[model samples]
Target: MIKRAIALAAVLAALLTAFAVPAQAASGRYFYGVHAGLAGVRDYHGYVPSTYRPGTPMPLLVALHGCTENSFGFDLLTGFSALAEERGFIVVFPDQSTLANPAQCWNWPLPTNQHRGLGEPSLIAGITQKVRSQYTVDSARIYATGISAGAVMSGILGVTYPDVFAAVAMGAGCEYQCDILAQRDPDEQGRAGWREMGSRARSVPVLVFQGSADPVVPPATAGRVIEQWAQTDDLALDGADDGDIDAVAESVVRGSVPGGRTYTHSVYSGPGQGSVLELYMIDGAGHSYPGGCSCSLYGDPSGPDASGITWDFFLAHPRR
Candidate 1:
């Protein structure tokens, strides 16, 4: 009887091991928890590279997920956690609850969610702050990136919390106040974004990625995001609406993945320093995360490596 009982215990342990969650890898620490802040309660997942030390400050990145997505799935879709381990940065993925939006989308279009210290933006920022409290984060090197609705919220973060995020990256997303700007042009949208920034306004560097063949988010919307950010930076530079920050591409480099979609890389110079905006237009690609894991529905492995490009951009543009 004793032998039989021990054998059953061993079988149970094997079953538990088989069903256990997989770790990020042997090289990094991956964790998840809930953060209750002034805005509300938010669930989040995080990854810290093995290279991180107790006293050393590491760059922090907040990655938001799109509709029908959650923090864990986004982490797998973009492969940002692996990238973080390789690059020695900390990454946080904030989950959107179904209760907030039935589709599990970030409320980027609503007025309440578009401003500073309000709604989803505040909740996301609160999550970021919470991560900071628990980790050694470099204040000036903090960055934000997202896809679809998540991408729109990333832009709103740049507008509403300019002091917190040093740079922004959008994937298959439109400009700030995109829903309301349907009748307006990119220039008008830029003005609205600048106004949204208010006194905390600064020229936040932005990187954009889009699929020319994307049926969900048309290429034009991505183009609007590029132009709108340029206009906002123009205004932020000298408090004037003048187009000092040229939206025109300083250089256009065309490339193609081995057997995948061809792409155009455009660089737009900023008002004061280096390129403020970089646009990657992937031809023939659909609405998906470029160069993401094939395991996810939104992942497009054959496209350009957006995650790598985003990290490089963030590293290049620390807050002054």
Candidate 2:
């Protein structure tokens, strides 16, 4: 009778443990209405590591989605939330107002949107402030990353809110807006725009990733952006060199910046960062996250893993 009682107690304990473990692992999702323009836009987000508790400060990463894309799509495609789990960071995805643009693209270039006090930049800043108030977030460690249109917006955010974001990573996007201007020649206006954009965030470090074969945004544009940032930092140019060209068939060019870091221009090697700018050029790859699902119009699985590489870069540099 004594043995049976002991066995029954053990069984009950095992059952309780099984139930409690899953309950502890469950994650919660939250939604809030953010005021953008005259109407309030609903922003949906999921905070991961489900184990996060109050008073625990964690690094925050704001992941923006591309045109015609939503938060759920970006979360599924990049799987960055998984990185948050391992790194113990809070990841937020802010949805673009589709009412403004049917495709839900970020307004990165419009003069009205580019200003510090209004438009998309303000909306994103508001989101960050809201999250900071609700959670214990490290202000100095705040970062932003995105895809395509969202990537362009990330650059915009870095420039407009340099005091807010510590670092930024852009995939398949350029430093300046690619739109054509009416008063200026296409080529001349493009160059001037890049220089102006570079001037805004002269001190902020940036990581840029582009596909060599990307049809949407040319690979050369990525190189130009890196050069602009390097020049802004007054870094010595190291010229071009081959990077991961054999196995992955990538090439790179490196330059030294004022700090102990070097600016790198890669054309196929795994993702890496230099001083103020780092470019990852995927050889034979198109405008998609490498090693991820080939769901987009331009996606290649044979290139370097961008999600992992970008996260690593962000971890190395915190806001100084």
Candidate 3:
């Protein structure tokens, strides 16, 4: 009977681990009334570092929540608000609307929603703009990030509105175009469209965390995302992988977590040694943020520290 009870307890724990829940925001306030054109309105919440003062322009991080996730839950998972408080920056989380998607997802896989200045992308950018307008925000240092669906949307924002976002980070996500046909590889025309859009938008730096054995998003998609972002940010319109458009260099480093999984960190550089793309491919990580708060719903503490590493990347690459 003791073994039966223990087995049942283990089963319950496994169920909880699989079904993720969003954490409540720690900065404590959930604000509303901010509206984006056509996309309607959603709740906004965040935390300001203790050192911040009124009228001082602070850097803003606009984080988007994944399906069935809330701003507060997102805050608890990534611990970005806590990091913001500690590092003297600002972090804002925007909730997804059920009207757009029943799951409250960002609608990243839809073809119609993939374009710039339209669909959910516009709404997200509007939230960032609204936050900037209300607060003393540093226009040049704004950034975006998310988990899963939200992460894919972050990639869309980076391509769609590069002028607004200085840098982007995504976990267990795909590129801007994740339609069914684009799953294996994006067609030539679609790839060209992304390249053109990114070029016109003044492409920003991107950081991606992809689980090698991701069950939802095929891990191959992450490599494709890197290829698209690297070529697009570099403005390489050439069709071949080994093309002489400009200079593309990559450096690789390997590391492991103590009593946990090992991972590979790859940084892709463009002209002037600027980091255009960074990829962390964790060997055993699933569909969650690496080194994130395990106590939170959607996190795996066995990988690299995402909040810390991504923030460092954000600081290094401001809008050019």
Candidate 4:
């Protein structure tokens, strides 16, 4: 049994290394480096727009990649860097070490990495702080977005580091402790997230995109995530789960990309805030980044423009 386990470990390590950290082609705006924080060291990449000035504070978006993907390739798949350049914001990509997870996943399922001031959450926050320190980042406009495992990690960050991340965008993923593999009650998972927030709890605007036909993550996962965030936000708003955020009526819109997939968009708003939560359910879409470049394995050219929608939502809702 020991020998078999060792062999399995070896194979997994090899597979992870195969797609680990490829050297990205040179781009003057794009840069890479390593950061060592209290938890550990991690590799990170940053994209600074050409219009950025030294003293000007621009919005910062932290993009986290899913399993089997790396920081260097996420932009290629999602076209986030291009959007950042056009929108005049700084974007950072925090890499996951293969040693941490054999599949290069963010380890969101592990309780050790779910809370504040511990594990992968700390490392990712450290990376975001490092970027803010180096670049002229608007603290109020800092946001996080990711896909799959990275999406789950983004939800965890919203709970554990609410002050650090003003809002979060998750694609093809579930909420914190929702555990797509285990499939628990979203309300319970949401309460757990609220507890994790502790005294730092606040309303963190969320943008979620889910594929209707996603095989790895069920379509119902989107509803689960929405429920979790609504519950968490409800508790955060008044320290009591009184159906505050949930009581607000959600506006739904149906649309489709030309010759692509159709989708349903839902927006949930707070009492004063325009929108605290937005969900996009893409019909017939698979477990891939919708409206992304098809160059990468996880990118799908069909469906709504998720990256664009996420940015618009992030821009609308800052740390207020």
- TM-score of model 3 vs. true structure: 0.83
Clashes of each: 0, 5, 5, 0
Best by TM-score: 1
Our model 3 lands, by Cα RMSD against the true structure, at 7.6
lDDT of 1 by residue, 135-244 (tens): 98999999999999999999999999999999999999999889544678788879888898888788999999999999899888877898899999889888987777
Most accurate candidate by lDDT: 1
Worst 10 residues of 3 by lDDT: 17-26
lDDT of 4 by residue, 1-320 (tens): 99999999668745543333223322327767798877788998777877889889999999999999887678778777777777788888998988888889988878888889899999999888888888888989999999999999999999999998999999988877866565577788888989999898898999999998899999988888888999999899989888878724479999989988899888898778778888888999899999877768887888788889889999998997
Provide the overall lDDT of each model, using Cα atoms, as 2-decimal numbers: 0.87, 0.64, 0.74, 0.85
What are the candidates' C-alpha RMSDs?
5.7, 12.9, 7.6, 5.2
TM values, all candidates: 0.91, 0.71, 0.83, 0.89
Q: Tens digits of per-residue lDDT for model 2 on 196-219?
A: 444343345678887777778887
Q: Which structure is stronger by lDDT: 3 or 4?
A: 4
Error of 3 at 9 (Å): 29
Candidate ranking under lDDT, highest first, comes to: 1, 4, 3, 2
Model 4 spans > 4 angstroms off? 1-28, 181-183, 247-249
Between the candidate structures 2 and 4, which one is better when assessed by lDDT? 4
RMSD of candidate 4 to the truth, in angstroms, is 5.2
Model 4 poorest 10 in a row by lDDT: 19-28
